[model samples]
Structure formats: structure tokens, C-alpha cells
Target chain A: MSRTAIWYWAARAAFGWLILLAAQVIWLVADTAGVPLSVHVTGLVATAVVAAAHVTVMPQWRYRVHRWEATPAAVFTQSGWFRQEWRIAPVSRIQTVDSERGPLEQLFRLANVTVTTASAAGPIKVGGLDRDTAQRLVAELTANAQATAGDAT
Target chain B: MSGPGGGPLSGPAETGWRRLSPRMLLVHPVQEVVRAAPALLGLLVAGTSSGGKGHLWSAAGVGLTVLFGMLRWFTTTYRISPEQVQVRRGLLNRKVLTVPRDRVRTVDVTSHVLHRVLGLARVEVGTGTSDRRHDSRLKLDALSADEAARLRVELLHRSPAGQFPGTQAPAGQSPTAQSPTAQSPATSPVSPAAETELARMRPGWVRFGPFTMSGLVTVGVIGGFVSRLVSEGNIDLDRVGPVRETWRWFSAMSLALEIATVLLALMVFVGVASTLGYVLAYGNFRLTRHAEGTLHVTRGLLTRRATTIEERRLRGVEIDEPLLLRAVRGARLSAVTTGLRSKEGGQRGGSTLLPPAPRTEAVAVAGLVLSHTPGATGGPSPVTGPDTGPLTSPLTSPLTVPLIPHGPAALRRRFTRAFGVHAPILLALLLLWVLGEPPLWPWLTAAALLPVTALLAADRYRSLGHALTSGYLVTRWGSLVRRRVVLRCDGVIGWTVERSFFQRRAGLATLTATTAAGAQSYQVRDVDLAEALRLAAAGTPGLLDPFLEPAGSASQ
Candidate 1:
């Protein structure tokens, strides 16, 4: 898998870990307030196991991780390990492209790019890219698509 | 020094005091009186009920109304400069707005009955996107018709050359007198030289038929009644009867007199609304053709609103013929534009320019507006332009698929089957009623079946054949009123195919085409799998290809 794909899995792992941590904190507080100690411990253990399983299973699916690609004509992303579906949106039809970075994303020097088309559905976001790289990719894709369209006409 | 050869310093001196037409005070007092009416009535009712200090409260209310009216009248002021128009007003937290000459989109000037008698019109100036906040924009009420016309001309001419401002040039100037290159800032020797001699103006106003006024009033009253019913339960019919009875005994003996009074109140409200619409639609109903080929429409009665149109920004034009207006050969023309701010905040900002005009003028006006802008071709016409390909046939369009099987035999079979299923339910209901065991089953069955039957009938009605001929796609569908929507293929924004589990089993899919404006969504359903794929491919060229291709090719 590519470095970007590894980073995506890492981010997903971190999200799962955060959820587990939150649950553990809640359980510990409940235990201190005279709740059953055994129940609190069981909840913490279950959360930690689920988080570890997510980190392991997500990285093992290399085919799903490797399926996303940006071309001059379209941007395609494929996920799901067994069923493996793909979604492609032509750049010419793209209405708007926006890049956003959250606090965690900023810390990781990453940004998410959402491309909106005139289709009824919500926009598609391709996450886990460095800010500068995402900007350059968007510009290059837009220019390439416009040039191709001009040539076709 | 102030003669023809004078320098900039010798020009007219700036005035610190802003002057507004005195006729504006008429509206100010009326607005104050209307706003205060509710409060005054409430105070009177409360004081009278308590049986003390009623006269004192009434006096205080009148004094407050007068003071507020005066404050409002004094605060409103507007000033026009060579490059910008600024309106500064408000008694406490003042708002100062500056609209640059170039940014002025459309100016609408209107005059109500009162303003017409006083020979004054209200001018509303609309600036693009940024000045969308309704209250913050500039409104000049009761300006002389001539001043409003002049301002409209100045705003139109100020935009870049080669753009259409939707207005005709002055009589003396040739249609193509101003060259686009000559007005370009890069080519021109002097920065502000083009400003002079750009103001040779023309006069014309757009007028709506009498039906438009009635429709506006009816729509307003219906909307008000519906909202009031939803928010504050039903009107007190008991209270209404007593009030009418009391009025009859006190003032009039005849029932005709009571009916007349109620009718008079409704008429007054409608008359005021319609008159307000008329005033805003007053002079310079003129759409000027700007040197830039953008159409600038300025009109208004109280607060003039100006809209600027760049041909490229316009998605499409909708010509509507309501049932009432159809006989008169009159239709309302509205252009859908991007970057429109919604009246309600945060909703989709789909801006439309509505100008009620004759059907005969629609094409001519649209052609004039589109002449100078880029990608201005590809409308619903048989003739093809250089930039736009031939209009596509609706029948063959990828977006148009059969909602049901199309053979005559198939149609007849489907119809009979639908009727057969409904007939049994109706018959069963009739039988139950005769037996007198509370016939509840039939009523319940009908209540459930009515919506489902309607849905089925609608699906059957919308089973239209579509074709793509040239650059246009023509779709024919309907049960009661058959409609043929001729759309330019290039204008189609996006398309999607939706399939339910039952539909998937039946080898049918629904294809929906989304365009820029209006509520009408083009949809065709219940086609074979192969046809669905073909139609989807045509609407969105590469949608199916990614899935069809070998797994690796799409991934990388």
C-alpha cells in the first residue's frame, strides 16, 4: 500500500482509539461513584479489544486501501474489502472543490478535499492528504479537465 | 474657475446636508400608523376592560406614533456620486451603504397611487451577492421619475463593455457604436474618460396585465390565512357573528351593509398590495443593453431593486403561463442565475429575475441578452449555432427512459388490470354498507388504496417517450395536461439512476436529470436493464464505465 493509504488507516485507528479512551474514562468515573467495579472493567476491556481489532483489520485490507486514484478525467475511490465498489465523478461536471483541515488534521499536516457535483447526493470527500499536495492536485485536475473539454469541442 | 475649463477643485462643492424628497414622509407616517395600530388596540382593550386610564393610554399611544414617524422620516437619506451611490440612515445604530457604479446589478423604480399623485417613484438598487442583506441595501423612496431613469442608465453603462445590460441604447447612438476593445481599461489612454458620454438614455417601462395584480393579492391572502390558521388555531366564528350583529344594530339595518364592510376591508388590503407592486414597477421598466452585453433591469415603486445579468451566469429562462393569463398571450419571464441569496437565510441561493412580459417578446429579449456572452447558445431551438450543437431529440435522450412498457396492447392491459383491482374494492365497500355492519372495512380500504392508486396512476401517466435530436432533448409526458420539456443537453447539470429492490428485480430503474432552475425534475422510470445503462451513459457519460471496466484499470 502507498504511504497515503497507510496514513488513512492510521487516522482511522486513532479515531477508534479515541472512542475507546472516552468509554474507559466514563467507566472509571462510574466505578468511583460506587457502580459495580466488575461491569466497569468489562466495558473498558471490550472497548479496548474492539479498537485493537479495528486497527488490525483495517490495515490488512490492502486492496481497499490501494483503490483510490485521481485522473485527469475523473476522481475515483473504491472501498469495501469483499464487495469492493467504486465511485467515479468526472472533473468536468465538478461544481465546486473545497479543502478543509480540522485540529487533528492540522496537527498531522493533512487536509480533506470535498468535490461537489450537481448530482442530488452530497459531495464526496477524499481525506488524508497534505494541504499543499491536495491544493496542487485539485488545481492540476481542474486544469487538465478544462483543457480536455476544450480540445473535445 | 467653475466654468467649462475648470480643474477638479473647481467642480461642484460637496454638500454636508443630504436631501431626500418630501414625499417619502407620506409612507413614513402610514408605516408608523400601521405598526402602532396593534399596540394601540391592545392598550385600549386592556384599559377599557379595567375601566380606568383608557383616555390617558390612547393619548400616549398617539404621541409615541408621531414621534416614531418623524424619527424614521428624518433618518432616511441617499447620495449619488460619479462612481458610487451611498445610503446612510437609522436613528440609533446607523447603517451606511456604498454601492460602486460597477457593482450595481439591477435598479427597479416603482410608484404607488400616493406617489403617482405626487409625481414620485421609489428606486431600489440591488448589488450582486454582497449587498444581498435586504435591510443593508440602498432604498430611495419618492425620487422624481427623471432622476430614477438617469441613475438606472448610469448603473447599466458603468459595467464592462460588451456585456448586455438588457436595455436598448439611446435613439441617436448606433446599436454597435461602442466597441468592446475601446472601453477596455488596458487599451484606453485615460482611466475615467469612458465615464462621460456613456449616459445618453432611453425611456420605456414594462407593464403587467390586470390579472397579475389579482393573482398577487389572492396569493398573499391565502398565504396569510394559512399561516394564521397554522399558528393561531381557527378564526373565532362565534366572535365574528356577535361583532357583525352588534355593528348591524348600531350602524346599519340591512345585511347588505355588513357584507359591504367586510368586502371593503379585504379590497383595501388587496388594493394596497397590488398598488405597492405597481409602484415598484413604474418608470424605466427599461432593460438597457450594456456595452458588456449584460442586461441591467432597474425598477421599483418604493425601494428600487437593480439586477445585473451576465449571460453565462444565466442557467435558463422559464416562460410560465398560468391558467388565468393563458388567454391573454401574456407570460411571466424569469431567468435562473447562480449566486442568488435566498430570502430565508442559509437555504439554497437560487436567484431568479421575474419580469412579466408578452410571450411574443420572450425570444427577442432572450436573444438580445445572450448575444454578447460566452457559451450563449444551445437553447430549445431547431437552428444550430456555431458554439452550440443542434438541439437533441427528447425521445432518444439517455435521460429519458420508459416508465412503463410502451406498446398499445401493454398499455391497455395495464389500464384494465389497474381498474380491475380498484373495482373489487369499491364493490366490496358498497356491499358492506348495504349489510349495515358499520361498513368500516371499505372506508379503511379506500383510505389506504387512494394514495397507492394515485401513485400508480401517476407512474402510468409519466411513462413518456424521450428523444435526443441535435443538441436538444425533448421529453413528452402527462395524464391530464401533456407536457413536452425541450432541454439543451449541455445545460444538464447532472443525472442519477435510482432503483428499489422491487424495481431491481423487475429490471427497471428511474433516471433523474437535474438542471439549474425551477422545481421541475426530469425523470423517466421502468426501463429494461440495457436501456437503463444506455440512458445513464448518455446523461452522465462515464458513470457506468468505471464499474464495467476491469477492476485494476479503475483502481489505478
Candidate 2:
């Protein structure tokens, strides 16, 4: 994991807190319009505590557990914030690989790679990778998939 | 009898288009006209609002339906070739579909009351392969009954491929496998296996019905009535004549005794309903092996059903013993055959080869339908004992090996999960106490349930085990309704490895072996990561070898 990747996650947390702050403001306005003042006050306090924890600590916690590796035969993703899951899909099972980038990701020079397999586990998603690394990984997985295309159903 | 299209997969594409039954003109349009009646009424009402032209619009709707039906009947044509079955239809937008031969898994013929009256039947072809984009099941809704039966037999019949290895497969197979040409229904003799009765419903088995969620229906009915009464804000119980009379009669007894009487009455009522329902569904149940290499199950009293499964598609049998049934030493069996996808009203019942019977008989029939001789194989003397030998699925496992448990770490994980589940609820209770009024009874109940949860977790851990035998892999899982499945390793098409955060911390992973047959996928949960990989590698050799390093190193 790179130092730049930490900023990308912190930016996301910052965006989420901004929404929470907006919701608290709406609640305060509603309290002025005959809604109870206690509800607005208590909700604001709860939101403040949760938002502070999210922006300060949760990003580092997620970064610690978020691990992914690509072997010659399979791609393994061990990632989740609270309930971490390690998913394995063999290269022979890869159906399609998709690369996506948001405007925020473009600013950070990062991209996310999603590898689709036929297994019922859905798709293996790996985010917060350098754009060059993401492209190379995609090319490698595609090559591996094609080389063993006929082996799978 | 050769097919009307002559036995060509690609040739005669232009001239060999054969139409369905001519009766479709009367049958299809009547259905369409029935569907159009509601819209015609809407049109009639709309026309009346504008002017007096409602009747004219209604007539036009009927005419449109008739025209569409006639056009569909005229354009639709089907052809059966040697390698593929093709159907083409639609006048302006012509569409063609061709199903390959080897992909065809099951072909079933069903005739409703009307179809039977008209000598017509519906033929369904299932390929056992479904993609999210395309539904592979095909339904030819109208064909001559005889033609439908013939086509079903021909499509479902597969030449028995390789011998089943040991002496067991040799004793079980019909010698006719020597002649592959006999695959055709016309040439194959229908009298070889001679309908041996595999299983028939016993009247006493109906007693097991009440143990299976029947009491819940009674409770639901009573709950509905009570809620309706409360919502209506009723005051006069006497006005409800039946309740008033029952109350008057029970007034002579103590209050507790009166309540008990009512509960007893409800129990008897529910018991009778469940038993009667079971008898109606399974009274005349009969399973037989016919010479066509198919198992036929005919049952039901009011609505008789006859379901057939080709023996070649059968991967194995699964004997399910739910907790209550297990208490009485009873079990149920369902076929793990391909193409018996869980769809339609009666598919589950169709796949069930045996209902809730004594475990001894259930296992005996399982060995019978699976073509195994228990006494001859010496028996499960190693695992079960002499008398109850071949009593469970492991005996039928390709190598007949006992299961290997995932050791104590799995038990620890289960206990942790169980404790984690209870912690939040207990915390909420403490929060209630902080609110200055702790509910004592609910808190005490939750406390009492902790040991039960621990026990359930321990049992579940004990139930989790896997065995990789010669040709099959057997995995035992679940505590309440334990399933010991013997899935053929060669039938396994793929493998999936999953590890949760807690599992990863403990160096454990869940390995799932997916096959084309028998419950689709069987899992070996909470095994050491290295061991999981080795098991996957051993089950399906070189496929997983590339992904796994040699023993001692498995950080991935």
C-alpha cells in the first residue's frame, strides 16, 4: 500500500462526513420549524462522534486489512472493513476484467480493477492501485484467462 | 421408426420444417381470447364514455386475438436432427433455436387434463446449464402424446460411458450397455428391468407430518384471529356464538384447565389436517425402475403425478434428516440428479425418491436406487457396524472412507461467533437497565439460552468434516438437518476458496467443490488454509496445483 492510497480513502471519508454534516444541519432547521429541539441536539452529538471516528481512525483500519495478490493461476483478494473476506478465483475461471476510475481517483493517479468470474462469489474487486499497476494487472489476467480459455466450461 | 426430418443436423434446413398439431388453432386462440376479454371490457367501457361504439371495439379485440393465434400456428415449425433439436417460428421476426445433443440432460413429458383429452402433451428439455443472460430450459408446449414420450426417451437416453471402477459397478449395470445402438427408444426393449417396487408410502408415515411445521400453521391462524379481534376493538365475546358456547361449557372448570382444553383441541385439529394432507399427497406413492433406464415416481390422490428421471443423470442420493425427524430415527431422500433444477410446483417432490421413513429402510432404498449391494461389499463394518452397514452416504463414497474433522480451531470459531451474536443483545439489555427499568424475565431468558447456543455451535463444528475418496468427495455439514453428501469428484467442474477475517486470523479457509450434479456444490469449511488447498488439489488434481504452493508455505 502506498501513502497516496491513504489520501484517497481519507478523501472518501471526508466526503461521507460532509453528507452527515448536511443532514445534521437539515435536522436543526426542522427543529426550528416545530420539530423537537432535543432530537436535533442528540442526533448532532451522535453524528459528531461517529464522523470523528470515521475520518480519523476507520481509514487506517481498512487500509491495514485490505490486501490483494495475483498469482499466475488465480487472483486472491483479502479485503473488507469490518468483516474481512478473502476471495479466490482461478485465472482459468476469469470471465471479464473491468477497470474503472472516478474523478477523485483520477486526481490521486489511481484506478480500481474488478475481475469477474463464473463462481457464485460474484466478482473480486481490488481498489486503490496505481493506474499503471492496474493496467498491467488487467493485461496479465486477460492473458492468463485466454491461455486457459478452453479449459473452463 | 425414423424421425420425419430424416436424421440430419444441418442438411434439409429449408424443406424439413414440420408444423405442430393443427389443434393449436382452437386451443391457442381460445386462451388468447380469454386473455383479451378483460381488455375488451375496458375498451367497451371507454367507447361507451365517448359514444355508442363500445360493442364495435370489443369485437375488434376478439378479431385481433384470433388473427395473432392463427398466424402463430401457421408459422411455428420444429425439426429434430441427429445432433441437435431445432425449433423455428414467428412470421415477421423469425427466430431459430438449436440445442446440441450432448448438452441435453433431461426430457420430460407432461399432459394436463385438457392436453390429455386432446391427445397432446408438453415436452420440456432441460440442459442443466443456465447462464444469467439465457434461460436454457426449453418447453415444447404442444405435441402428440406418443411423439412427446418418444422424444423424451430418445433425448434423455445416454450410452452408459465408463464402468464404475470396482466390482460394485459391474454387478449393478445392465449388460445391454454392450450395444450402444439400443439407445433409441424404438429399438430398446422396455421389459428388461421389470418395474421392481422401490418404495411405497406407509400409512404410519403420516404421523411424521405433524412434527414438520404443522403446529406453526395453527398458531398463525390463531394469531391472525387474535390480531383482527384486537384491531376491531371488540367488547362482546358472547356475540361470537361459538366462543360463547365453548366459554360457557368451560366455565365449570378452573381457568388454567379451560385454557389447556382449548390448546388440546387446537392440537388435535392441526394434527388431523397435517396427516390428511400427507396421506393425500403420498398415499399411493410408488417408485420403480423401468427398462428405459429411468426412475418413475407415481403418487398423489386427488392430482396424480408421474415423474421420471433418467438413471444416467443421477450423480447420487442425499438423505436429509432434520432434527425432529432424527429424534425418531426417520429420514427423507432426494435425487441429486442434474436437470432436476428446483423450479416448478412439484420438482422437489419429484426428486424425492423416498419420504420420511425409518432410517433403516431409507438407507436400504438409497443403496438400491444407487445400484449398490450392501452385503456383497462386506458392509460399513469399519464405520457403522454389520447390521446397519452401508447405512449412510459414506459407505457409498467411492473409497468408503471415514470423514476427517477440521480439528479444534473450527470449534473455537463457532463458539466465538455464537458469543459475538449474544454480546450485542446482552449489551442492549444492560442499556435497558441504564434506562432505570431492566426487564428481568427477558434478560433471564437470554441468559438461559447462552448454553444452548454454545451446544449448537459445538455440534455444528463436530458436523463439519470432509473426505476425498477415489472417484468422489464426501462432505458432512449442518447440525439440525445434517447432510452427508457423496459428490463424484470427476463431476466437480470447479473450485472456490473463501476465507473470512476471523478465518484468516486463524489461518483457515473454506473450500467449496462445485460439481454439475448433486446439490451443485459441497463445502469443507474452517479447514487450515494449507490443508484446504491440498484437499482442493487432490480432489481436482492439476487444476488447483498452479495456484497452490507446496506444503509449509500458504500465506495466500
- The prediction achieving the highest lDDT against the true structure is 2
Instruction: Give the TM-scores of the predictions, in the order they appear.
Output: 0.58, 0.64
Candidate 1 wrong stretches, greater than 4 Å? A1-98, A107-109, A114-124, A130-132, A138-153, B1-20, B79-85, B98-100, B112-117, B127-133, B136-142, B159-312, B319-333, B339-556
DockQ of each: 0.13, 0.13
lDDT per residue, candidate 1, B333-367, as tens digits? Answer: 44544323323211211232334455556434543
Q: Specify the CAPRI tier of model 1.
A: incorrect
Alpha carbon lDDT of each predicted model: 0.51, 0.66
lDDT of 2 by residue, B1-556 (tens): 1233233323354555666667666667876886675566667767776788978987888899998878887887777655577877778888887787666666655565556667776676666553323343566667766667656655644343122122112122222232342232222222333356788888878778765544566568768766654444333566889988877888989978988998997778777766666676667788887544568776776544557776655656676777777778887777766556532312337577877777777777776675521111110111221122333355544323568889888889988988899978977886787786966767778888889998989888887888765445677778798777765554455566777767878888888765445455668888988888777777655555544543347633
Cα lDDT tens digits, model 2, A117-141, are 5433347789989899999999999
User: Which residue pairs show collisions in model 2?
Assistant: none
Best-fitting candidate, scored by TM-score: 2
Number of the top DockQ candidate:
2
